[model samples]
Target chain A: MIRTLAGLVIVLILGAVAAAVIPEMQMREELQGVGYSYASRGMDETGSSNLVTAVIVAYRGLDTLGEVVVLFCASTAVVLMLTLYPIGVKASEPSRIVAFTAKVLPAPIMLFGVYFIAHSHLSPGGGFPGGTVIASTFLLVMLGSSSVPDRNGRLPAIESLAGLSFGLLGFWGIMTAGQFLNNAFLGTGTPGSIISGGLIPLISIAIGAKVASEFSGVFKAFRNSGGEA
Target chain B: MTETLMTAIVLTLGGMMVAAGIAVLFVRDLLSAIIITGFVSLSASVMFLLMDAPDVAITEASIGAVLATMIFLWGRGKIGDDG
Candidate 1:
């Protein structure tokens, strides 16, 4: 009876809130009006065909940087936790099919990831998704193989270098353009060209490297901990 | 016409999300629950795509649906079978 009453109260509150907010919700037409204006301005300002990429890497770059830092911190915490309670046996050998697919898949995946990062300024993908795709390739490698050889601490070094480059690039922007992460340092070439969107593609590459290494590092740490691959 | 079609897709995906959420709550098996959670993330990604947010959709599908599930399954292996 009490549970039923509680459910009723929750439903009542949700209904009331929805009723209040529903009328105020903007329709698609209204949203498109605002979005179109932004898209027009964003295209000119960022000199990229992909407005979303411009928004993420050019207009709201500081926010993206903060987001990268957050992911870095989270990966760091995962590493720390694994270090504290290192447990789990090495992963057993995967099945033959898994092994075969793993061998066949990683190269293509890496290539696609690189393409995604490189073409982000002119396409649908960007650093974050591209990085994740690359990391997933690493994950596939770890899954298929019984033991992956240690890289003599290369992953963390890559991560650190990428992060440092990102920061330095931001500072370069500030020095050149009077705004942090500004794109004024490089010329905004033709809109759909590979070299277009000054500072965006560069930043995307840095972020892609940093994020990919960070995630791969996290997976490595977790694998090293007592859990199987 | 497009608006109506979009609304239909949104409702369908939203319903799927709700079903997945409920399944996650009631599923006894931890691994199954984690998979269901991935389904929820997948549905959410679809919703994001319907909303014209491809960047967010990609992020959601990769990190939320794929990576999070992989991590959860890994953790579950460490925790043993009962969980």
Candidate 2:
């Protein structure tokens, strides 16, 4: 078939292109620009074992704030759009297995999300993922059951509070340490302990709360109208 | 020995991901395409893990593979059979 041949040819070309370009995605031993500084001094500067956390949450914290704001804007836009032009199609009820799984899974999933947010500086995850994982729990419940979630409710307040917390934490850093999102003001603690990462975990928790609430709000908007948002 | 093994694994995963990506394009069923795209993302996550970036790997697996797939499937379901 033409589709098969076309796919093969496309794959061959893309594979070649990938072979050349994909190496860039790999971690280079000699990092460039501020990346080099982050790589060398991140742990020392922030006392965070995970250098990625140090860079994103400590050094380039302002950029991360911007990223969170971007997500906020997107969530806001999605909620507003769906609120105005709601989907008309009704969701098909999930299977019995899905409903049961939904009921049993949210608790453990929530715990896992919390662990990710809390241990992010010591481990591989951080706020964005931890929060999204929490949001998925709400999404699962919506998918499994016929219950209408509270769309216009207390979650927006939580979202607002979380967003404010991020800025407030930044201001606290500025007041105490003369830098935005400065981790050293609170003392970075130890390298690998749960409390070691200082402002990283706190900021991650704030981000997680904001993301979870926003996404849950979006999910609720979709569910409330009896359709996808 | 480990270097060789890692290289082989990377190539295999890369190939699998490309194949999945192509297959998604040609797949007739929307559900199958969505699942194939998730397969692509999962493979990329595994590749990320091999590349010594557990943070990227976790994000790719959780967001790119799981949540994106779920949202796509939900939207597709709502779009109905006519779509």
Determine which window of 10 residues in candidate 2 chain A has minimal summed lDDT: A220-229
- Per-residue C-alpha lDDT of model 2 across residues A84-113, encoded as one tens digit per residue: 887675667778998999999999999999
Tell me, by DockQ, which candidate is best.
1
Compute the lDDT of residue A177 as modeled in candidate 1.
Answer: 86
Writing each residue's lDDT as its tens digit, candidate 2 over B1-83 gives: 99999999988888888888879877889889999999998888898888799988888888887778876876887785454
How close is chain B to the truth by TM-score, in each candidate? 0.88, 0.90
Positional deviation of A100 in candidate 1, in angstroms? 2.2
What does fnat come to for each candidate?
A: 0.64, 0.68
Classified by CAPRI criteria, candidate 2 counts as medium
Residue B19 deviation, candidate 1, in Å?
A: 1.0
Q: Tens digit of lDDT per residue, candidate 1, span B11-83?
A: 8888888988989978888888999999999888888887788888988888888788999998888786583
Candidate 1 docking band: medium
Q: Candidate 2, which segments miss by more than 4 Å at Cα?
A: A1-29, A94-97, A227-229, B80-83
- Residue A44, model 2: lDDT of 75
